[model samples]
Target: MKIEVRDVVKSYKHKTVLKNITFTMEGPKIIGFLGHNGAGKTTFLNLLAGLIATTDGTILVNGDNVFNTPSTLRDICFIAESGNFQEEMTIAQALKANSFFYPKWDEQLAQRLLQVFALNPKEKVRSLSKGMVSALGIITGFASNAAITIFDEPYIGLDVAARSMFYDLLIDQQIDNPRLYILSTHLIDEASELFEEIFILQEGQLLLQKTTDEWHKHIVAVKGNATDVAAAIVDLEIIDQHMFMQEMTAIVHTGGHPIEGYNVTLESVSLQDMLVYLSKQKARSGK
Candidate 1:
């Protein structure tokens, strides 16, 4: 599957939430849509899922406009933090309904996942806990087998153990049945390994998009004596810094410069820390 977003913009009233975002992705791979709160991650995802219309530009999945097009939408599945099921419907009934809509829906997979998550098929949607709701969404996303499956913070209210189980199941399912998966979340460290590419949104703009390996190559953390650390990164752009007594640590964008020979130790930056630094820098710069 291929998704193309070209100069897309979304606004509510007069305030724009997504600004001129443009990108194209192809093939079956896991993509991370990451950003701080209110960075328009959900808004963008909704646009792609056709839940909301774009204010400007276009979004195409497999060369067809997905908005209000049932033919194209049938191949797409979007599961939110909360499952969207009829309040009075039983889990079994909801799964049956989903099978009617999705051409590739797998009832066997749904049953297996329901058992794996310990959710009773006869339970009403309103009676499930928040974690169970998330589990239901997960099950729906996996079993739909849509060519394009998107998960927007689908692990909300899940405990650590349950979340781990979700990650394992996602990996296993992807291995067995490859499809395009877009996961939007703030748990960068835990889910970072699953993403082939990461897209970052900041203040309604697509701030950055890079492959995981490429992203790591552009930013690094350095720690050493305050003076040496400062000198080592003097020529580079510093995204963040910390000073404790005589020791200093700084996150710097290498920008193709060889960073060495300043008596400072350099290490790869964590995805979480890199994002924090980038967000802070953007805020400080008033961008």
Candidate 2:
């Protein structure tokens, strides 16, 4: 599957959520769609799922307009946080009902995952806790076998162990049946390794698209004397800086090259931290 967003804009009244955002992604890979709160991650995903209309521009999933396009819609399964399954329906009933929407539904996988996730098929959806609901959503997403599967912070009430299980499932599913899996998440440090490619948004604008490695490659932290930190990053892009007595710490973009020495210590920044700094950067001084 191929998804293309060309100059997309989404607005509500006078406020714009996504501003002329544009990007493309292909299938058979795990994609990380990342941003901070109010970065329009959810809004963008809603547009991709055809749940809402774009105020301007277009979004195409496999060369077909996703909005009102049943063909495209059937191939894309979006599982968001909370309220996924009907409150009145039993686990089995809900699966039986939703499976009909996907032509490539994997019944055996669905049944087996019920056991893997420790969910009883006969259990009522309303009785299950938040974590259980998230597990059901995860199961449905995988078993749908859709060309594009989206998980928008679906692990809301899940614990560390459960989230790790979901991460393992992502790798397992990719190996067995290669397809597109777009994951929008805030647990960047934990799931950073799962991303083959990533798109980041900041303050209603698209930030950058890069491989996970590329996202972390040039970002470094230099700490030492203020003069040494300044000298070390004089030629590099300084993302942010902090002063502490005589010494200082600065996050720098090293232009993809290793910095040898300048009386400072160079340390690798976490993927989540790097992204935070990246988002703080503006395209044109915040206009």
Candidate 3:
């Protein structure tokens, strides 16, 4: 499956949330959507899943437009941070309902996930704990087997052990099913490994979109004597920097050589760290 968003724009009450955003993704892989709060990631994901319509753009899933078309959206599943299960229904009943909606639903996987999450199928949606509710959402999203599956912080209220369980299950199921997974989460480091590609939204703008491998390769962190390191990076734009009494640590968009006298330590940068630096840079530039 492939997702295509072209010239996408969304606004509420004259305020734009997504501005002229354009990107394309070929499926059967996992993607991590990273951004700060109110970065329009939810809105963007909603648009792709057809929960909301774009103000001016086209969202195509597997070559078919998702808006105003039920057939096209049937292959896509979008689960929010809060799973919108029927309050009066039991977990088993809700699972059955979801099975009817998605053509490729896997009952075995759902049942297995229920045991994995320690959720009782007979429990009513309203009676389940917050962690249970998140567990149910994760199970459904993964077992639905939709070509384009999107999860918005699917493990919101789980404990550390539970969250790790969810991550392990997601990885295993992905290897077997291999559908498109779009995950939005604040737990960036925990989920970064599952991401083959990355999309970053900042204040309603699509700031960056690249593969995880490529993003890591393009970024570098250096640490050495403050003055010498500063001189070495004088010509380059510093995304982020930390300074102490004598030495300083800085991250930059690597371009030229290192300073001769300074002892520089060039190290790999994580996607989360890169985004932090990028966001800080954007903030400083605005001021």
Candidate 4:
């Protein structure tokens, strides 16, 4: 499967949610869609899933416009945190309805997941707990076997144990049936290892897109005396800096080279820290 977003823009009542976002993702891989609150992550996903129309530009799935296209829509499955189902509909009925839209829907896998999540198939949608709802969404996403499957904060009310189980099941499903999976979540540290690549959005813009390994290689943190830290990072792209007393910590793009002879200690930056520092840098620079 191939997805292409070109100069895409989304707006509501004159307020832009996403601006000139462009990227291309092809084949089967797990991608992390990350951002702070109101950074347009969910809005971008909605555009891809054709839940909402783009205000400008275009989005194509396998060279076809995704908006209101039945053929392409059938190959795409989007499971959000809060699923919308008929209040009186039973879990079994909802799953059956979903199967009609997706050609590769697996009833057996859905049944097994319902059992694993301890959800009663006969229970009405409104009667299930918050976690149970999330579980139901997970079952739908995994069983759909769509060419493009997207999960937008799909573990909202799940406990630690249940979330762990979901992750495990997701890995197993990916291994057995490879497909394009785009996951958007606030639980970065927990789900970071699952992503082969990451796309970061900030303030309605596509801030960065890089493979997990490339991200690790490019971002570095250095700590030392203020002068030494600045000297060591000279000519490099510095994302953020902070000083406590005489010591200073700097986040920089190292270009994959060790900085030596400046009495500075270089360390790999965590994904969370990198996001924080980059956001701060953007803010400080009025970007």
Q: Evaluated with TM-score, which candidate comes out highest?
A: 4
TM-score of 3: 0.89
Clashes (N, CA, C under 3 Å) per candidate: 0, 0, 0, 0
Q: What is the overall TM-score of model 1 with all chains considered together?
A: 0.91
lDDT leaderboard ranking: 4, 1, 2, 3
Tens digits of per-residue lDDT, candidate 4, 1-287, equal 99999999998996999989999988699999898777898888888888999999999998999996879999999997675567689999999999998999999999999999999999999998888889999999999999899999999889999999988988999899999999999888888889999888988998778888988777888899988898999988877889988889988877767688889888888778767776676677675
Model 2 clash count equals: 0
For model 2, residues 1-287, the per-residue Cα lDDT tens digits are 89999999999997998999888999789999988777899898888988899999999987889996888999988998666789999999999987999999999999988998999999999999888999999999999999999999978788999999999988999999999999998899899889999887878887667776876777778999987777778778777787878779899767788777578887878769866676566433462
lDDT of 3 by residue, 1-287 (tens): 88888999999996888889889988788899988877899999888888889999899887788897898788888899774699899999999999999999999999989998989999999999888999999989988999888889888779999988878887888888888888999899988988899888877887667787667655677788886677767776576898877779888765444445555777788877877876786688672
* Candidate 1 runs further than 4 Å off: 224-237, 255-257, 260-263, 278-287
What TM-scores do the predictions have?
0.91, 0.89, 0.89, 0.93
lDDT of each: 0.88, 0.87, 0.84, 0.88
lDDT score for candidate 3 against the true structure: 0.84
Q: In model 2, where do residues sit more than 4 Å from their true spots?
A: 231-237, 254-263, 275-287
Instruction: Give every collision pair in model 4.
Output: none
lDDT of 1: 0.88
Residues 184-217, candidate 1, lDDT per residue (tens digit)? 9888899999999888888888877788887788
